[model samples]
Target chain A: MNTINQYYAGLDMGSVSIKAVIISNQKITGWALIPSGGNYKTAATTVMTQALAAAKIRREDLCGIGVTGLGAQSTPFDARPMSDISCQARGCHVFFPSARTLIDIGGQFTKTAKITDKGKIADFLMSEKCATGSGRFLQVISRILQVPIEEIGELSLTSQHPIKFSTNCAVFAESETISRIAEGAKPADILAGVHKAMASKVNMLLKRIKLAPDVVLTGGGGEDAGLAKAIGQIIGHPILVPPNPRLTAAFGAACLTMETTSG
Target chain B: MDTQSQVKTTAVKGTDTAREVRPMVKDIYKAAHEARENGKKVAYMMVASHYDEILRAMDIVPLPTENYAGLCAAKRDMDRFLLRAEADGYSQVLCSYARIGLGFDSLRKELGHIPEGSPDGGMPLPDMMIGSSAICDPRFKWYQATSRYLEAPTFSIDVVAPPPQADLNRVRDYYINYQKEQFQGLIEFCEKQTHTKMDKEKLWEAIRLGDKAWQLWYDIDRLRVAIPSPMPSQDHFSIMVAGHYYTGTQKAVDFYQKLYDEVKYKADNHIGVIKDEKYRILYGGGLPPWHTLWIFNYFESFGAVFAIENVYRGFDPVQVPSHVTDPVDFLAWRTWLRATAYHEKARQNSGNPTVEKLLGIIKDYAIDGVMFHACRSCRATTVGQTHIKTELGKYCDLPMMQLVSDMVDLRDYSEAQWKAQIGAFIDALEARTDQE
Candidate 1:
């Protein structure tokens, strides 16, 4: 039997968020999510320590470290830095072997990965250059309404008559949103419309990767019911969203740690 | 006009020297006279000076492609040629220029395309071609694919950027020499096609004139980005179209000199939006879509003036050698190097893996935030955006926004969601400024 004594760490350094997960001897240990806040280095260090604390493990105990995501190669930890696509695909595949597609929509970037049964990326797509249709985009609209980020999904689900906003430039879209408000467009409808736009963006991304079935929605924005429904409507198929979508990456990272340590 | 009256409508618009179709009354008469005398068909396409070397070498008269009715008229053709443009990641998330190029490509094909060429007229497409992929990779693939159909010979000049760690100017100088060789090779190709030896003296003379024209614009460009923004986008856009053809001719000198005169006049008289411009964002590479003026308006709302773009600016930066000096050789020399110099510099910079210089750029430009676009397949620009972002974080407290979209293909953008991201980015900028 494996001793389960060895420890491993996985760090995902992103534009707006930092996530870390720790595993001790092939069992899911614990995870941490913190604001990257434009400081990838600091965010990395902080998240590592936080994960250690959550798992009740010592940093010295970590035997191997694996980092992934946008800032993966830039983290302070000495480990093999993999592309975000590989990490997400590998992380997601462990829980569900049948899952062929993984959609990771973070606060800043959205990545859609096509995973094989062997946990290798056959192909992938990402929305890293532009932040439109991303989670932070909704943060902006929600802030204007002075609502909490957590509440947007529920509110969007309740909206009637989806309000359509013209333009793809975020700067202009915000201004257009003001037009929607001026036109007495319900916030729910406007949110639904925004959700529809996101759906379209994701649909386009999926089409490129051949639109893999058994798609799993992960990341911060994955929890949004409206966005999932919108995406479902566009892809013309039912999609699965992991519970507490925001914690999915960390969970995946935690699982990554377990795989590395046991081996 | 009937709703679909498909009379021969000239699709040429804007100032793209590569695609513009101005019926030169005299040139037409001359080509007609020559063709009539020789019993040959007369046709021609005017090319920008930058690419003039290639088109001329191929014995093709290159004409600048323009965008008049839309911000970018070439979007359709580019889209058609590159069916999976967005999927392939050739465009950055915000590269609307690529999108516009698609339009131009689409509209022009309807009227039997004009190949870039002669000061006289359209290129006599005999059945073979060769060119460079320096500006982009798609054109290389496009030409190659076209050749597959026509059985035309095509050669691509792969661009190599200098190592960022190496001497920047030295790298530029090196590429200049290489460009000249490529240009000469192209010239030889043209000679073979025309069945005539090009007078070295005339070619050199053309080069000398082209060098002057290119230099004038670069010099003018350096001065255009004043603290009080000296130029509007409309003028900038037009100047770029004209500037493309100025690298190797009397045309460069004339157009740039006139541009300088206009800009100097405006700057001296304080004629344009030059005061209290809070932020100056580098428009960066690719096309900015007029269809989405709201994108610019978003920045303008935050008092951010997109001062200058490298793409629209064209290949104008240079030192104009004396007129007495050999000019064509100089242009050919530089053209070879331009393809690879910037990439080499970026590679060199990343070798040591430090963000100090990137940080300095942020400070020098007064850029409170960095927006590193992750273009889908433009390995040249988007290869290491995330890495750059990490390095950038080391240097300053600026918020970095990475937006996603296909720069060239229009069918790829998610209209509403893209707007959402930009809106958030502006709000972040505004919030940052307010805090400051």
Candidate 2:
């Protein structure tokens, strides 16, 4: 008897990060991430190679490739691409089956999705197109604080009484963050405060989706402790942070294999 | 000189831009009288320039389709649009812009009357017309209903598109046919007024001038893709008027090249869409329509770049399925399918089949945000803005913002609301910037 492995791939070509996930039978087998640079093609191929390596599977052993992300349709292999919401929901459901609400805080956009009892998207919402709470926004702010992003998550945990910044515009926010530094505010506190603001921005969208219980926060932004705690506190619920929040979309992309590939 | 300074009406006299505009304004004033004198209600029929030809052929004084005057009455008018939708049992797929417009339009602004005589450059009501070119599906139906209510001749141009199976050559033929029909209707209307056979040379001149204007506009746009986003979106309206109205004349072409050269100069100085350290944003909003294209370009100097617009490229999908014998219908439909995006235009704005297809462009172009223009006059676009924004977030996880505007009513603008909304929106974007 001969059998073929059914593989699904999800590629999230976000403004800040390019993530890819390989899944089989709705299980996330492996994942990879790379910063989106001038040429996304290189970024995409790098992540794909890493994910394939992590999964210990050859690229040719796949039945179908399902891509989902901001740049899903642009996936190189002509693999079918689905919406980010659909892929995120599928990805989040793999871990916490009851996670009906998903709030993906990526680099450039904050997306809130309400999932069905069957792990499908029932409704969704997003913040305005500006970069305040997204990865793009964070990159600019991080430069002002001079803190490495990987360290932002750990540093935010040490803050006590974070300082709040006024003005929502990214340019102005950057200025405000600089002023806080000038005033000798603790870098950790300022970072926490900024994460609080992001949480507030996300809360607005969560309200649109009715803030159902058991929220799953994913995306590159989800890796920040300040954001995770702030979001959890704002919504008055315990938010679920996956092992690697940034990998959720890509992980979900891999798991999105139904023989038909139709919604 | 920058096109802004060159086209400033206050600066130049005897220039064709001023000349054409002066006469059109005077004629509108006269025609307003002509209609009232003929015992016909002189309605100020404002419409997107995309629908100007059809409206012109219908002998109506059209308003420049633009952002609303300032958002007061228009916002309240949403109730009327909602009522209309409720009565019609609209599907959930409809966006909020339409619901609001229909609700707003249905309201009795002042006791069953258009309040006789408020033509101080305000959007005048039409006696028997409602512009519905179905730029999206909902507006098509809304205008169709409005026409029925006014008992006006509401001619819907179904923008019959070519299939993906059709060859590119066939598509070019389709373009020729659609262009002919639109021009034919325009010519017939102009002929009835001027009593001339549209003088084929004049039609050819208009076409040539229009194409040149487009090229010049594209050249100018190339500069917009620079750093600090280049020019802000606020100036897009001025650009549109210069491009839209003046595009018909040689003055526009000259003005455009002059503007382009200036932009090229600034770009040479390193002051454009590609700043060394600014983030570029490709913004996707509904068609700038008339006076609001500048609003879309406002993000230029703020580390943003709008590389393309899905709405502006309705012609991107222009492919002819068969030979069109009636050049007049062809031209009208060509204009229809590309712009004013009502029924015949088949524009892929909100609440239309093309909305999903448009996502492909947004992705392909790597746009930073999707700005959906929720126009009050455009039932097709306005009703489902919320849904379109939400769906984009859901499907593509794309960030979207909406400017609740009118197709032409400039009075509906609200500097305060716009600023606040933009502030909030920008805040969200900033927070997402991967802050340390």
Whole-model lDDT, model 1? 0.56
Cα lDDT tens digits, model 2, B1-436, are 1223221112111112222433433344455556655754433222433444333333344433222221212222233344454565654244444443333344324335432322233233445433344345544455564442344343444343443334435465565466556445544544454344544444445545655776777666656554433443333333444554443466667766766776666656655433442333434454443433344334443444555454432342233224643435445554534532232222333334445555665555445555666665555545665665666665565445676555534444443335334433443344344231
Q: Provide the TM-score of chain B versus the true chain B for each model in turn.
A: 0.66, 0.54
For candidate 2, the lDDT comes to 0.56
Query: Each model's TM-score, in the order given?
Result: 0.50, 0.46
Model 1, residue B97: what's the lDDT?
A: 39
Model 1, residue A24: distance off in Å is: 48
How well is each residue in A67-137 modelled by candidate 1, as lDDT tens digits?
76657657898776545555666667766677888888876667776666665555455664455757878
lDDT of 1 by residue, B228-346 (tens): 55664434554554445333456556767766776676657655453457766654334444334345544555566655553444443444444425555556445434433344435
lDDT of 2 by residue, A1-263 (tens): 12235666677777677987777676667788888787777788888889888888878866666665665545677676555666677778888898989988887677787776566665556565577857777778788888888788688889998887787778888888888889999989988888888888889888866778889989877787778888899999998978788878666666665434633
Error of 2 at B324 (Å): 48
- Candidate 2 residues lying further than 4 Å off, grouped into runs, are A1-5, A258-263, B1-436
